[model samples]
Target chain A: MSTRTVDLVDYDDAVRRYDPVLGIEVHVELGTVTKMFCGAEVEFGGEPNTQVTPVSLGLPGALPVVNRTAVESAIKIGLALNCSIAESCRFARKNYFYPDNPKNFQTSQYDEPIAFDGYLDVELEDGTVFRVEIERAHMEEDAGKNTHVGGAGGRISGAEYSLVDYNRAGIPLVEIVTRPIEGVGERAPEIARAYVKTLRDIFRALDVSEARMERGNVRADVNLSLRATPESPLGTRTETKNVNSFRSVERAVRYEVSRQAALLDAGDAVVQETRHWHEDRGVTSSGRVKSDAEDYRYFPEPDLVPVAPARSWVESLRAAQPELPVERRRRLQGEWGYADAEMRDVVNADAIDIIEATVAAGSSPAGARKWWMGELARRAKSAEVELAELPVTPGQVAQLQGLVDSGRINDKLARQALEGVLAGEGDPEQVVVARGLEVVSDDGPLLEAIDAALAAQPDIAEKIRSGNLGPVGAIIGAVMKATRGQADAGRVRELVIERTSA
Target chain B: MSTISRDEVARVAALARIDLRPDELDRLAGELDVIVDSVAQVSAVATPDVPATSHPLPMTNVYREDVPVPALPVADVLAAAPDAQDGRFAVPQILGEE
Candidate 1:
C-alpha cells in the first residue's frame, strides 16, 4: 500500500464524510509458571536459549502437553469481558514459515475458539461508555523473540545477524479479538485507547499476565476501515501490528484514519495489508503485501486433543475475578471525595495505585494526592521517567508527610528532605538527620538568637512592643539570618515579642 | 496421475528455505506425489460409520503442573543452532518483522 501518497483529508472532514470501524486484537501472554506445551518454564529474559524444551524448539520427536493454568486464564479473561465460554474446543495448527517460530507452525485456535461473543463496557475519561463487542479469545503459543545484533540497535532491518530467544517461544497467550466496532464518529481514537486501557486493567486485576504494554506482555493489533456512509460496504482495512503502548494505540488509530482517507480521496484503493507503527516517526510504513501467504492452511492439531472445560471450572474462574479498574476507580473516587475532574487527573497520571498505597501508609488522601501529583510528578516529568519507576515509594512519601505533620520538619525543610530521600540519603527521617533539616523547635537556641536580634534591632523591636507587629519581620529576619535559615521564624517572633514587652 | 508439478515442488522447497539442484528438484517432484497420495489415502479411510479424529488416542487436557523444570543446558541448546553468540541463537538477516 502507498503511504503518505496524497494529502489526506483532515480528521474532522474524514469523520464527517466516512464512518470509522475500529477492530482491536489484543494478545496477552499468560504468566504461567511453565510453557504451554512443554515442561520448560516460561521466563521473560533468561540466557537466550535456556528456557526452551525440545517441544518448544520443535524437535523431531518432542510432543506438546497443554498448560492448564493458561486455559484457566483465558476463560477468566473471557468471563471478565462478558463472554460465553466454549464447552468444547480443540487446538488448530496455523501453518506458516517464520524463523522466529521454531515450530514453523503456530498452535492456535482457528474457527473453534474457547470463548466468544463478549462485550466490554469501556468508560472514557469523560465517562462516555462505549460497548465493544468481543469476537473471541483463543489460546495460542508465542513465537521466539528475534534480536538482530551487530548494528546500531537490535533491529532486524540492517543487522548483520539475529539472535533467537526461545524463552518466549511456546508461552501460552490469549488472543482477544474485537468485533468491528461502529457508531463512534469522532471519538474513534479515544474509544480505542480507553478499550485497551480497560482491558489492561482487567488483566492486571485478574493476575493473568503482568500486562506491561511497554514490555510486550500485552500487545494490540489495530484493524481500521472507513466507509462512505454507515450503511455502505466496509472499505479495505489495514492492520497495524503490535502497537506497543496505550498512547501509541490511540495515535495509530488516528493516523490510519487520516492515511486511509487520503488514499480513498485520491481514488486509490487502500491495499489490504499489514503496516508497522513507527513510534519514532509517528507514522506507519508499509511492511509487506498481504497475499495468499496469509492462507495459513489451518487444521486441527494431531498432537493434542480437544479441551472441554467443566462448567464448574469456568464458573469458579469467573467468581475469582477481582474488582476491575473501573469499579475500583468509582469506589476510590467516592472514598477520596474527588470531583470528576480530579479523579480523571489521578487516572490519567496512572497514580491511583500509588496514591492508595500512600494513603494506606498513613498519609491523608488529600495529602497523598497533593505530594504525588505535585512534587513527585514534576520530578518524573523533568527526568523523563514513569512515576512508577521513580526511586521513592509510597511508604517513603508517607514518612516525609509524617515528619511535616509531627512538627519535626516544617513544610520548607520537608521539601528538601523529600529531595534527599529520592537521592538515596535513606528514608525521610534519615534524610532529615543527614541534611540537618529538622525544624528548630528548641526555644532556648531560638531565644538566644531572638535576644541577639532584638539587641541589634531595638527600634523595630520597640515598634513591635507598641502593638504594631509589622516591624516584627525585622527581628525575625535577623534571627533567621543568624541561624542560616534553619530556626523556625514563628517561634523567634514569639520570643522577640515577649522580650520587647517585658 | 500426480497433479503436483516439478515447478510447484521447487516453490515449496524455496519457501522451506532449501536450495536444491535441478536433478534433485526433479526427483523431489515424484516424491511429492507419493506423499500427497499417502495423505489422501488416510482421509479416504474415514467412512460414515467412523468419526473425524485428530489424534490416534483420545486425550483431553493433558497438562503439566504449574511448576518450573530447569531448562536444558545452554550448550545443548546452542549446539542445535547453526550459530550462537553470547549464549543466544544467532541467525542471518530477517527480511520481515511479522
Candidate 2:
C-alpha cells in the first residue's frame, strides 16, 4: 500500500514543477424501472438478489433485451452535453472474472459508443466557463455490488467472506469519459468539481437519472496525471475510482496531483493503476494496475441486437428538451425581478432547489424566496443541515405562505409556524393548531384589547383626538402586547384611530 | 504478427491471475502465434470501405418497454453460486487482488 507516504509536495510547488492532466470518467446509472438488458427492476435498496432476472443472473437460456427508456435517456444526456449522437452502437462483453459479475463479463461498449465528441461548458462558482471536452459516453451494464464483511470496517482485507448482490448487475449506465483536461493549474480541483456539479445539474434537469452521488447513481472516477510541464508528455496516471461527491471530486484531484508529483520528485514512476478513494480518510490507495497486457477481450454481444438510433427520433428528443440550468436561472431571475445580488444570495444559500420546488407548489416567487432564503435558511444554518433536508418540505413552505396570503396569519405568525414545522410540529396548519399561532382577525376581541390599551394610555389617546396622533404608537403597541403580537397590526392601528377619534 | 515471447506470455498470464507452468507458457506462445496470424490474414483482405461491424446482424431500435417483470426467486438465483449465506452469494474476501 506504499506505507502511507506523507511526503506530498506542496500544491503550489507541485503545479509549478508538473502540469496536471485530468481525465474524468463519470458513470451515471439510468433511472429506468427495469434493468439494462433484462426485466430485473432497478431499485436503490432491495433485499439481496430479489430484483435479479435470469438475464441479470446470466442464466444459460435467458435472453437479453434492451430498455427503451434507458436509450432515450442516454440520448438526452448526450444532447445536453453537446455530443454527437451515434447512428449505430453495439454492446461488447468486457470479460473479467470477478465474483460480482455472475456472467464473468460485463456488457459494455468499446469501439462503438452511443455518443461521441461532446463538450460541456462547465461554469465554476466564480462564473468561469471551462470547456471540458468529452471523449465519449457509452452504454454499459453495472456490476453487482460486493460487500466485504467480517473485517474491521468491512474492508476486503482480513474479511472472512464477501456478500454479492446482483440487483444492480444489469442496471443501465452511461459512462461519460472526458478527454485529458489540461492547463488549469491550481484551479484544476475547482474545474473538476464544477464539471461534475454541472453534469449532475444537467442530469437532474433532463430528468434522466436521480443523479444522487450518495446513492451511487452518478459516480466519478478521477484520472489524474502530472507532467513536468505543459509541453511534456503525459505522465503515468492513476485513476481514483468512484468519488461519490462534489467536494470529494475536488479533493481527489488535488490529492492526486500532490501524490503523483511527490512520486515523480523522488525518482519513482507513478504506476498506471486504479486507486480506491477512501472518502472517510480522504486519501486514495492503490487498486489494480491497468496494464497493457491485461485485456478484457471485448467482443460484441451475440444475444443483443445493435442499436441504430434514427436521426428523426434523436431530433425529436432534442426538441422536447426542458430548460437547462443556466438558461433557467436567467429566466428565473428575470421572471422574479431579482437583482444580481439578490439572485446570487439565493444561489449561494443553496436555496435554489427548495425555492424552485416551493414556487412550483403554488407559492409566489417572492414568497418562496422570502421564506426559503430568509427564515428557513436561518434555521437550516443553525441546524447545520441542508435546506432540502430540513424537516419541513417545500409543500409545507408553500402552505405556510398560503396561510399568510389568506390573512389566516400575518408574516410574524407565519415565521413562528415555519419554525414550529421545522421543529417536527407537523405542517403549517397543524403547527397553527398546536401552537395557536394565528392572527386575531375578530374585531370584537381586538376592540376589547384596544379599549384596554386606551384605558391604560388615556393621555396618548386624547392627544390623537386633537390631531397630534404621533403618541398613538403606545396604544397600538399595548394592544399588540395584549394579543401576544397575534393581532393584525394594521387592524390595531385602524381600531386605535377609531377609539381615539370619538 | 508480432513475435510472441515466453516472458511476455508469462507476464500476461500473471496479470490475468492465471498460474502457468514454464512448459505450458512455451506451448501457448507457439499456439497463440498461429491464432494471431490467422486473424491477421482476414483483416488484410477486408477493404476499408466496409465499416467495422461489431454485431453479427445489422439491426436497430430493438428495445423493450420499461415495465415490471417477474424476477427469479432468491433461491433460484443463489442456487448457482459456489457459496451462500444469509440469502446472499458469498465468496472469499478479495484481498485487493484480482
Q: Write out the backbone clash pairs for model 2.
A: none
Give the Å error, residue A453, model 1: 2.2
TM-scores for all predictions? 0.89, 0.90
| Superposed Cα deviation of residue A118, candidate 2 (Å) | 1.1
Query: Can you tell me the CAPRI class of model 2?
Result: medium
Give me the runs in candidate 2 sitting further than 4 Å from their true place. A348-350, A360-362, A377-396, A405-408, A419-438, A441-444, A454-475, A490-502, B15-17, B49-53
Model 1 Cα lDDT, one tens digit per residue, A1-502:
3334545578888888889999999999988989888879877667678888789899998988888888888899989989999998999998887778988899999878999999999998878898999999999999998877767576556678887788889989999999999998889999999999999989988999999887899999999999999999888999999998999999999899998998888889998988899899788878776646345768899888888899999888877778888899999999999888988999999899999999899988887898899999999999988887899999999888888888888777888899898888899999899888887888888888888877887787678878888988888888888876777777777788788788
* Candidate 1 local lDDT, residue A70: 87
Global lDDT of each model? 0.86, 0.87
For model 1, the stretches where C-alpha displacement exceeds 4 angstroms are A1-6, A149-161, A291-294, A433-436, A481-499, B1-52
RMSD of each: 3.7, 3.2
Residue pairs with backbone overlap in model 1: none
